[model samples]
Target: MLIRDYAEIFPEWVKLAKVACVIPVSSVPAERGFSLQNRIKTAQRSRLGEGRVTRRMHIASSRDTLDTFDFNSAAARFTAAKYRKK
Candidate 1:
């Protein structure tokens, strides 16, 4: 109520408030990420590095379903990489 009345006089504060309001009040997203990381870094594959973990997290959290994802291009890129061992 008070914020609405003073928004015109204090535009900067209003912008800050709007940004703050969008922030999550809970840590559910962070918790989910940690949980995904745990599943990706299990005992048998514990040697995975931070870069691998981050990339895996991004893939795991991607909004695109498997059917919509272009796996052929990804496979082509992987096979084209000369750095990979035979």
Candidate 2:
């Protein structure tokens, strides 16, 4: 941390530090979904059910920034599926 007076003297350095801070400290989030598949798909979960566990994987492993699914389209598909079957 710099004193307010010192910060005026080193404005460029402060800007550089701000840019560097944006860089990720660790790259874990990039590979999180794949890395966590085994953890989420435990031996007990795998044997008890197949489709049940798979349905929840996307929610469990997806990045926090990407959760805006279009439920309207999914609901439309659900309605259309029944008519197509007949």
Highest TM-score scorer: 1
Please report, in order, the local distance difference test score of every candidate based on alpha carbons.
Answer: 0.88, 0.72
Return the TM-score for candidate 1, rounded to 2 decimals.
Answer: 0.61
lDDT of 1: 0.88
TM-score of each: 0.61, 0.36
Per-residue error at 65 for model 2, in Å? Answer: 6.4
Candidate 2 stretches with Cα past 4 Å from truth are: 1-34, 48-67
**Per-residue C-alpha lDDT of model 1 across residues 1-86, encoded as one tens digit per residue:** 53689898998888888898899999998999999999989999899999999999898888789789899998898888855765
Checking candidate 1 for backbone clashes, the offending pairs are none
Winning model by lDDT: 1
TM-score computed on alpha carbons, candidate 2: 0.36
> For model 1, what is the error of residue 35's alpha carbon versus the real structure, in angstroms, after optimal superposition?
0.9
